[model samples]
Target: MQRGKPLPQKEVAQRMEVSERWYRNLESNAGAPLTPEALIRLSTALALGPDERLALYRHVHANTKLGEPEPDGPEEARSALTHLLATHERYPAYIVDHAWNMLDCTDPMADWFPWVREPEANLLRWALTAPEAREQLTDWPRHAALYLAQLRFALVSSRDNRQLGALLDEVLADPECRRLWDEETKVVAYRQGHRFRLRLPHVSAREITVTSQVLLPAHRQELRYVLLLPESDPAPLPNRGERDPAQCRS
Candidate 1:
């Protein structure tokens, strides 16, 4: 479909570089499974984002790989990810699931962004709706827009995810968030190589610049590790137990 209107089957077949009959059979769910190449072509023809592309792969996987292992439960995933977070003790690190729900964080992350310790902490919700976010994140508009863009990207593949749908509804209630959601069309799913200034009241009065890098566990692609690495050129701040910041930027 192009926007809200449905593209003709012939047009879709043409875009996929496939015969109209073949596309119709695929659409009717009455043909052999698509090859990886065909799937890629279909995804491209539909203009799917990363999440949607993954969704397409999973759909094929479900039909073919009945012996695949089940996903790790929340508690199991949290325990494993705790060790992962500890490994990055020098940086601000945290784990989030597909819905951007905070599962765990390094002590340094909690110190710098205590909101992660909140009940049922969700990254997109706080970033988009919380008043504290504006105070802590410099260039709030850009940051909020990025968060919203990620959510919009997720929406493509997470249409059936109740948590994601609820989170979207809650954030869109805010006037500013609603405006951003309506106006932002970009689809950025990760924060790789994104540097932003942050103010941590418990850390230092001065704003610190940090580049956010997102990583995925090899086994659990649904979980993401968001690590905030302080630009190394600046003099780092002193650590004071769990109350101190992890890194500093001048």
Candidate 2:
């Protein structure tokens, strides 16, 4: 309902080159489910971002008890996050579940860490035990320590969730993880504007800012989105070179 314009029904019909009556029915949620074409038209008319557009489609036809079940599986959640991440090509974006598991990543992420293609990789594990973690992180100890602290916070906040709790135990069972967790230190509270600089396998160390947002009741698992952006534009970094940075640090 944009101001100074005809009703949404009329405007939508004109934009889609369809009958005003049909558009009215659709707008009123009385028409049949939207076809892909109709959905695209509506999305365009509304200037919807990928996530917003997907939400709109889901809203129109979703059958969940509530709108919370659209991303029920890892793949569905990945797809949703991927769509949003695709919107930012220059930046690296990723989605992590409540357990701090890295669920999905964008191309820029792969460019920074090629072995991210492995079946399932946890950012927490990599940050703590991977040698590449040490090499890539400009301030290895500090970043690793901060990451552990964040994971601890997430664990405490979601203690009642069996799955999340299990993940915490599994990660902590690793000797290195245990040592880090044993340290009775806590960092500042998690905030979105924090930034860090890290060196990648073949890439020169570059500064990157981290931004995070909570996707409420996300994907039935309280998943969150964490995006990484350049602190300032740096020359593009290499993807992979002589080292396999994915291996665990000895």
Best by lDDT: 1
lDDT of 1 by residue, 109-138 (tens): 777787777778888888888898998899
* lDDT value, residue 140 of candidate 1: 95
Candidate 1, residue 163: the lDDT equals 84
Q: What's the TM-score of each model vs. the native?
A: 0.74, 0.55
Worst 10 residues of 1 by lDDT: 241-250
Error of 1 at 158 (Å): 3.5
What range of 10 consecutive residues in model 2 has the weakest lDDT sum? 241-250
Clashing pairs in 1: none
